[model samples]
Target: MSEEVAPHTHFQYADARHQAETALSGMWLFLASEVLFFGGLIVAWTFCRHWQPAGFDAGSRETVLWIGTVNLFLLISSSFVYSSGLAFMEAGNAKRLIQCCVATMAIGSLFLLLKFYEWHIDISEHLFPAGPFKINGADAGGARMFWSFYFVATALHAAHMIVGVGLVGWIALQARRGAFADGWLTPVEVIGLYWSFVDIVWIVLYPIIYLVGRE
Candidate 1:
């Protein structure tokens, strides 16, 4: 494989291996904090659900299961595409790496669009907690609380996806400029780790929010 000149900033590192290790470590440290943040929310939701089983189920049943499932599929597909991009980077195939990055971004954007549509439907159905929320045949207060957690959790997750999509697009542009050449693909790998974490968080959130009461 051909080697391009390393950037001056990278000169601080002894070699590409060390630089990549440091970058990945930094990303994991950041994600650890995110884990704690989201974990708190999950714990709180678990307590609420345990306290109000009937209302939570009624609220969960009201969710559009198909949309949630589709969103999950899209997120997982994006992660796969991103992993492929990482492999392409390892093989020094910049062209294929760029393609994978763009594909991942497109998949992530579609997930966000579907999310907005789902939120619109919820708003129309009087599901927004701030509004006069309505869930027929469920304890109104408990149902309101359920929707409150639902919107807050999903909205935060969607925001993270939007950020991830933008990061992937930026990486694609950089790849087009040949910045990831010469095994200097640490940035791409770091971004992939962050994106994967976001995807995993959603995977956990989905079952709690959508599949909890579907028995």
Candidate 2:
């Protein structure tokens, strides 16, 4: 129990600590469910790779490594910046929070741009598994499966990034208006959690999608 304050913006609970705990718990629950969903994709990837290691490796080699590497750098850095925004919020520095949020969104958008560019390169190279895939021979099917998994996983990740960008922008707008001061920092904290989750998924994906076949 703590001193009761008037109902804040998002949290109706008067106890500040209770509100923080509730928000954190809710975010963890949501992220846990997301982890389960992504876990299925990883399981599928494992099975497919086990079945056709050569094909999987071959498909991995065809991917443009540099772009993926760059995107990973951008996303990881953006998450760090977003974390700083959360720190700023905790310190009651709305100005820094807004700046960090905007920077996070910009970096995330750059990652998405680079990702799409790589996808475009993939298309140009005829790596897309659109039935008549260029990855010919007996191992072609396995290679196609690998590419399919790659597309699905990356697409889902990009969608999540897009949503994160929007959320950061919204938080920035709110912060600009002084809406997040006086202990109303739940939104910043929870959104940073989400952004960090997305970055972690990409961290896992980067090695799987880029490093596996190189060896």
Candidate 3:
């Protein structure tokens, strides 16, 4: 019999294909947990929407619909940036990877700008939940409840965006130093998955928060 090929596995860094598959598997598992977490919010939203349909609808109308719509587009574009970034990193194009990171962060910043403006309008109208929550044109208490939920949920979403921006910044720095030049693109790919998941959360939030009451 021929000599056996002893287990050379210890000398090998993990199999690249196996590593990528594992990365994707872990990401999907994490995403599943995220879906469940957000699912609870949707359930609560449904209950409120059922109880106070008019109020919910009216509150949604009060929002600058165009603002939320534009933000949705911005996030979708950012997801593309992160996706392309992953492609570039995998293909060993460090410069392109950095470009992608910049683009993603820029788009995320645009979302925050629009969000801040929306908050400004709401606050100016004495429509903030904590203090003056008077809507001159609707059932004030219901409107207050509606805006209360709106403020809470969207604020949380914005905080997540902020965190995404920070993570992307760190990714950018790593790319600049040729950190991903070798077969070490795993971290970048995993973080991109996280960024996309964050974007997906907002995708669901946008419609529920802004489209529920629209005619």
TM-score of each: 0.93, 0.94, 0.86
Structure candidate 3, residue pairs in collision:
57-213
Model 2, residue 17: distance off in Å is 2.0
Report how far off residue 211 is in candidate 1 (Å): 0.6
After superposition, candidate 1 runs with Cα above 4 Å error: 1-8, 136-138
Q: Write the per-residue lDDT of candidate 3 for residues 1-215, one digit (tens) a residue.
A: 23323221122336666656777789889889878877877788788778877777767778878899999999999999888988977888889989999999999999999999999998887768677565655556566778888888888788889988998999999889877777577678778888888888888888888877788
Among these predictions, the greatest lDDT belongs to 2
Best by TM-score: 2
**Superposing all C-alpha atoms, what RMSD in Å does each candidate have to the true structure?**
3.3, 2.9, 5.5
Give the alpha carbon lDDT tens digit for every residue of 52-116 in model 1. Answer: 98888888878888899999999999999999988988998999999999899889988998999
Q: List, residue by residue over 146-169, the lDDT tens digit for candidate 2.
A: 899999999999999999999999
Q: Distance (Å) between predicted and true CA of 172, model 2?
A: 0.1
**Candidate with better lDDT, 1 vs 2:** 2
As a whole number from 0 to 100, the lDDT of residue 102 in candidate 1 is: 85
